[model samples]
Target chain A: MIQVGVNGYGTIGKRVADAVAAQPDMVLRGVAKRSPNHEAESAVKREYDLYAADPDRTDEFEAVGLPPAGTLSDLLADVDVVVDCCPAGVGAQNRDIYDAHDVRVVFQGGEDATVADASFTARTAFETARDADAVRVVSCNSTGLARLLAPVAESFGVETARVTLIRRGGDPAQTDRGPINDIVPDPVGLPSHHGPDVNTVLPGVDVDTAALKAPVTAMHTHSVNVTLETTPTADEVRRLLADESRLFLIPEGAGIDGAGALKEYAMDLGRPRGDLWENCLWGESVHVSGRDLYLFQNVHQEADVVPENVDAIRAMATDTAAAESMATTDQALGVGLESRLDTDTELPDSITADD
Target chain B: MIQVGVNGYGTIGKRVADAVAAQPDMVLRGVAKRSPNHEAESAVKREYDLYAADPDRTDEFEAVGLPPAGTLSDLLADVDVVVDCCPAGVGAQNRDIYDAHDVRVVFQGGEDATVADASFTARTAFETARDADAVRVVSCNSTGLARLLAPVAESFGVETARVTLIRRGGDPAQTDRGPINDIVPDPVGLPSHHGPDVNTVLPGVDVDTAALKAPVTAMHTHSVNVTLETTPTADEVRRLLADESRLFLIPEGAGIDGAGALKEYAMDLGRPRGDLWENCLWGESVHVSGRDLYLFQNVHQEADVVPENVDAIRAMATDTAAAESMATTDQALGVGLESRLDTDTELPDSITADD
Candidate 1:
């Protein structure tokens, strides 16, 4: 079994640790946290042995009625793959830590692609990451865009893709961010970093992204417009995405109103953390007027990458192909099942060809 | 002042009557309703004279503490123009009523193009509807689509347009409709009739629409993709949409999440019925890659068509020029002010042409 240690116990790290634990072929060795705070306490409560990232802060855990399993150095020695879920920039600082231990490492989106051997979106970048020493899973936006675009690229051949990401102000637990009641060009740039990040997975796909952070904290919704090399019917586009297990086409008749309702629906479905691990695509929204395909989809920022981390863990520690690893991760996580987010399968009249 | 009467005191009809009353150059003579429901009582409460759509059901008004001012035929006699906001197909049935009275008529989008002398989207079809005996305003979807497309077609020239309408199941007060948890093709076909309806206003414009009815009740969002004859930058696309009074480019700082928060924002702004009369375009969403332009925009179902109906009334009842009518209607209804929806005006680095 592959021993996976998560080197950050925040939103993504905690989930990644849980996901690694859930994988049949993997074992959650421990998770590292900088402080003995509530999250660290929760990690202890969940029975995950905690390792202090800062060796000097080992006493902080003991002071809080909890004891550290060991320093992060101990984690590096025991774990086969260390998933670095450090806050932005910190992962880069900790790069030498993993290298010194000679432990294969997996970094979350926070780290730049340069921090790893390859940027990974399991569906597209898995093969490239196999046996790689350091792999960085692309950000939520990249993962979402890559998952949806890869299928289209494989089937119809995409000429270009334009996606607008309406991002949430902060994570559900992140009370610190936002213009509160405003949207701003994130990172203050055009074709924000997300588009180029997507290219890290799909390599040469022509994609440009316009991004704005909304005031809400639910998830990021991508309004996608794709120009395909071939002019396909709407039905053809629907079947292509529907066949991909990660792209959950939200069918008509589902009581989901918007992201707000989608969250509630996930909670009602008893999803852990009300997570939408797969891309939530609107089936009825999928349209092909001619050579263009238009649709709106959402990516759960914290949870979508959990399974990718699981697959990346397997890729680093085992010889399983990306597809096989993805299938196993998906099955273990109860994903890729007939989606409850969109239950109806009937096609709209505008998409149906006149037979 | 031109005399105007509205038929069917439902969602679109009620708003049209209020819009007519708000116009300085137009007078609301009365509104007709078949049943003396709460809406008919509201007409009385708002000091709007209520007329019996069915002359034989005059007592129904008296039973609900609503006194009928007169019959619909009496309304047609007194009013110079009738805005028929009757349900779909019912406006077509009422075609004979307007013809018998020889009164110029305005029909809402529910009626087909054949129901009137010209199909109307004030921004695009006002000239064609000018002084016509009858003008049919396109559907909420058509009106929204036409308003956005006309500007693009005028400035950049559109080659083809594809729109996917994520529609609300029914109006907030419309409780009888829906699968409640289901999204269904309204007509069970591809290239929904909405695209054709848009063509009625902007004739010869190559456009096709895909439609789905979600369980939402607030507003309709259009996922739009258009191939323009000229290639433009994201900045050019933003500036183009920003300049249009009917298109409110929602910038990043506004903090509006989806239609829910958008409605709340409108209500907080003290708009009547918490309505957003203009299309809420995401400023950060406007993207231009090569010859294609993509964006996500919302058309407030009840409020968007109000000002358009006012313009149509002036187009038929008086010799007011289309531009004059639009300016007047936009001014009086507070339709086209600097949208409080998107507050920021800075350009993103991607779209900003200069370093």
Candidate 2:
């Protein structure tokens, strides 16, 4: 079994631990936490050997009424791979921990290119991190735009893409978000730079993206306008999109509504906790009139990237073969998380098996 | 010369007055205001002989250092058409006003059906209002959806159109609009009554719409998921859309961004005011992949519907020749109101000329 240890027991980290533990090929060695906060205490109560990062906490382990788990050093001792679910901008510090432990690390989006020494986007940036010890899953927006644009770019030869991304100002933990009742312009700058940022992952694509923060937290819905060098029929295009496994095309007869409906659908499907692995795509909303086509897609930031991280982790741990990495990643991250969050149930067998 | 009088000088009304006055064939007879507030007095300085709706201020017409433009009744005396820019459910009162003066009246969407005898929409709703002296402009969402859906329904037999309307919480004026930062489901229940309401205009087509109010006042964007009975090529559908004068297809080659770019293009084109007569459609964004197609469109509520109101007015006025009336209506409305709000420069003769 591939021993996996998760450093950081926050929302994403905890979910990662549960996901890793659910896999047949994987065994969760332990989970590390900061100090004994309410959340950390809860993790400890749930039988996760929560390790405090502070060395001082190791000396006080007995004095504090907590479990007999050791420090970060102890958690890193026997792990093949580590999923660093630390806060944004803290990946640099975590990188050192991974380097010191000589373990492969899956870093979140908050870290810079220097932190991972590898970029892990499916399309543009995937090959860049091919040999690097660390891999980074992009932000939710980049992943979403990249997925949609990749197929179009390859098949149709994209001329220019003008997209208006209606992003939710609040993350799951953020309480205060928005000018509440107003739709402000993305940023008052040309190209908004999000498109260029996406190009970092999707090379050779000329994309100009503008982002507007709306009063939402669940997902970001993108109003994408793409100009293709070659025209493709809407039907042909939908077929191409449906080919991607991560993309769940909202079929014609399906009565799904917005991102909320999509999230609820995944949750009902007994998906991995948080159900972030699936891309909620609407098929009928994909209208291609002439060389131009329109598509509406909802990208779940926290959840979508989680599975990508799982893939990155597996790739880092085993040559287990790149062709099999994607399938393994989905199996590792996609299934049980949805069920856990929904029914509060433990790991289910269907999800743990690699397809 | 066509004499146009505005009854309520609010956000839309003031723009209408300036629009009418700028036209060579139409003359602004005067405008009706409540009382001589600083804003109203300033309107008088711009030569809109202000009148009062308050009965008590009937005689104060001469006392306010203004012309004897009379009360709301007096304002209607020689006016060929009166445009009611009043609040919701109140524009119905203009029916009596129109009948008394034996002139057609243009009503905004704010007026409920009970308030007005008939509704005026670009998508054949005028057929229902064909007999009335009053014609009502449909709500912004209704108007935008109807215009986009009409051709689609006619060409490919609409199976079902599921639309998620992200509406502005309130107009720029209203203080309290919504659940603030929360994404609240539109409480009115099932397949929003809007689709049914549109069928009133187009009898055979079946459509469904859901509305959610965001906290912004600029423009309302729709996430439209439509499944047609018969599938057509995306290009074919785009060609049909391109044929419509009010529908602008944002082609792919341009470096333009979102609807904002479309708005700027309209402004540069010397439209009557910076109002858009057609839907600022993203042409390249219309994607037809397989049987599924996607499209993104921006509806400028204040701008797009303004000219439609003018069209409905002319259509309602000409009782003898329906075809001629509609033909004139299309041309008049197509003059492109994009120039009106551009810069403080007079519009080009071709755009400002009255039909």
Candidate 3:
């Protein structure tokens, strides 16, 4: 079994730990906590070997009515991979921790793209992590764009891709993230840094992105406009998208609602995470009129990226077959990739990379 | 045969003319044009009586664009009803033209609610024009909210309805509306006026609306979240919605896109107006999770209000039975009501108010 350790236990971290527990080939070696607070106590109850880093603060958990756990150094000794689900600015500091222990570390979406030597969004940048010891997952917006753009680019040569991201007010944990009641033009400019950020993973794609933050928490909706080198009918485009496993194409006559269908369809598909994993596609929603086509899809900001980290880890395990493994995983998990059905129901060892 | 006159030969005016001409009970009396411009010439070539409204003026088209064939006074003499497809602010000025000619005129949605004594939207305010000789149609956003909200409210007792309107950027005439590159907030406030505006038609419902304008054309997409007065299953709500005739419920398993299916569904239905005479509900898109239901629906701003204008005219033609006729037309049109069959059949008497 592959030994996996998590270095943070916040909202996304807890989910990553839960996901690791669900995988058949993975085992939780241990987890690191920032403070011996209430969250740390809760983690301990879940059979997680919680640990702290500061040597001077040995019994912080006891002072907070918590059980005693080992130090971070002791936990780091045995784990093969440590996922740094730490807070945004702080992940850069923890890079030294991974280097000292000589173990691979995975960073969350919040960590800046510059934090890691390589960024991992599964669709765009998983290959970059093949030789690196640490990998940072792209932000939710970048991940979503990568997923949608990859298939469209592959199917039709992309001349230009433009997107407007309608983001929610805040994550449940992001108390400090801004104008809560009003819709603010985030970045307030064209070609938002998202295009460039996504390029870190997908180097050659020329894309422009814009963003807005609305006062709701359901999910982020993207209005994407792709100018293809060759135009395809709406039906043809729908067929391409519907062929993907992670993408759920909503039928036109069904009168399905947007994110509502997205969450439900994801849940109904029996995804491991509830409405948190997978992307929802409205099949008939993609409209090709003249040279233009329109579509509506939803991106669950937190859960979609969790699996990308998993895929990036596997890609780093070997270089010779990294591209093929990454492509296979994207086919399995990325939205809008055509599903390939073979005579054999199960993938062989040649295709499966142990992360 | 009822003689229906269109005063403008613009995009909506031409469609209105076509819709009226298709009906057996209606006769296309003639179309008025301010100038013999290319579009007006096209309307004339279609064998519509093309009369220059203002021979004395050079830019006759601008002055008489909405209801295109002739001067308001000229159309009043022969036509029983006149559709003021005129530009915004011009509708109010032409109100006297309808009054002097002693002809009932139907105004487009551009004019505010205060444009006429009564406003007609398929959603809430259709009844307000029951006895009035002249009426206004509510904007596209109100029309969409009314259709979705009425069903959800009646079945689940919606505590509050909050909606975010993703409006297409350009006017129908503007060609660049497609391939939207940016998403902008309508304004920086909660409870946008769109929800309040809907109350005029709905009477006693409370809704909060926020709008964002994106650079795409075709239709407006709304992301709505409703807090129910009582909890219910998503399937129950979807069933309740699917029962509505004017609403073509997009099915679940079939992959469908939004406006693309809606427009095609309307066309296939042979709807007299081509698009829906009422709002199009997204059936498969609706999802319910623990009393919280989500979905997205499309509202054609220009074409949807056309039929309501017809209904309002039918009411004015017989004032003693105005309320009765309004109710009849509302039921027939399935406004503020639900009908089950997903049949694509057009009403026999479906025509513009000019008829």
Report the TM-score measured on chain A for model 2.
Answer: 0.85
- Candidate 3: stretches off by over 4 Å: A36-38, A53-58, A173-178, A253-255, A264-273, A318-355, B1-355
- lDDT for model 1: 0.77
The DockQ-based CAPRI class assigned to model 1 is incorrect
Higher-ranked by lDDT: 2 or 3: 2
lDDT of 3 by residue, A1-355 (tens): 5678887765466667766665555677777765554345445656777776555555655555444467777877887777877767677888887889988887766777777778877655666787788888787777877877788888876777788888876543333445555778887977688888878777677788888887544468888788887779988887787664555565443223555334333332334333355565666568776666578777776567766766766666545354555445444443332211111111110100000
Best by TM-score: 1
Instruction: Give the C-alpha miss distance for residue A164 in model 1, angstroms.
Output: 1.0
DockQ of candidates 1 onward, in order? Answer: 0.01, 0.01, 0.01
DockQ-based CAPRI category assigned to the predicted complex of candidate 3: incorrect
| Reference-based lDDT, each prediction | 0.77, 0.63, 0.62
Q: Please, what are the lDDT tens digits per residue for candidate 3 over residues B1-355?
A: 6677877655456656766676544577877645443345356446777655555542433332323445546666898888777656666777776788887777776666776777665445545665677776666677667767887888788877778888877532343233345687766676677876788777677788888887544478888888788878777887787666445565432123555334433432324333455566566567776667788877776566655655556655544353454455545443442222232221111100000
Task: Residues A1-355, candidate 1: write the lDDT tens digits.
Answer: 8888888876688778778888888889999888665456557767899998889978756765668999999999998899988787788899999999999988878777899998887899888777699988888888999999998999999999999999887764344556476787786778788888899999889999898888656688899999999988888898889999888876554434466556544543446666689898888898997889999998888678888888888887788987899999998887863532233321111100010
Alpha-carbon shift of residue B244 in model 3 (angstroms): 46
Give per-residue CA lDDT, model 1, range B231-345, as digits (tens): 9888988888888888887756444556765664454343676678999987778888889899999988877888888888887777788888888988888876353223332
- TM-scores of the candidates are 0.50, 0.47, 0.46
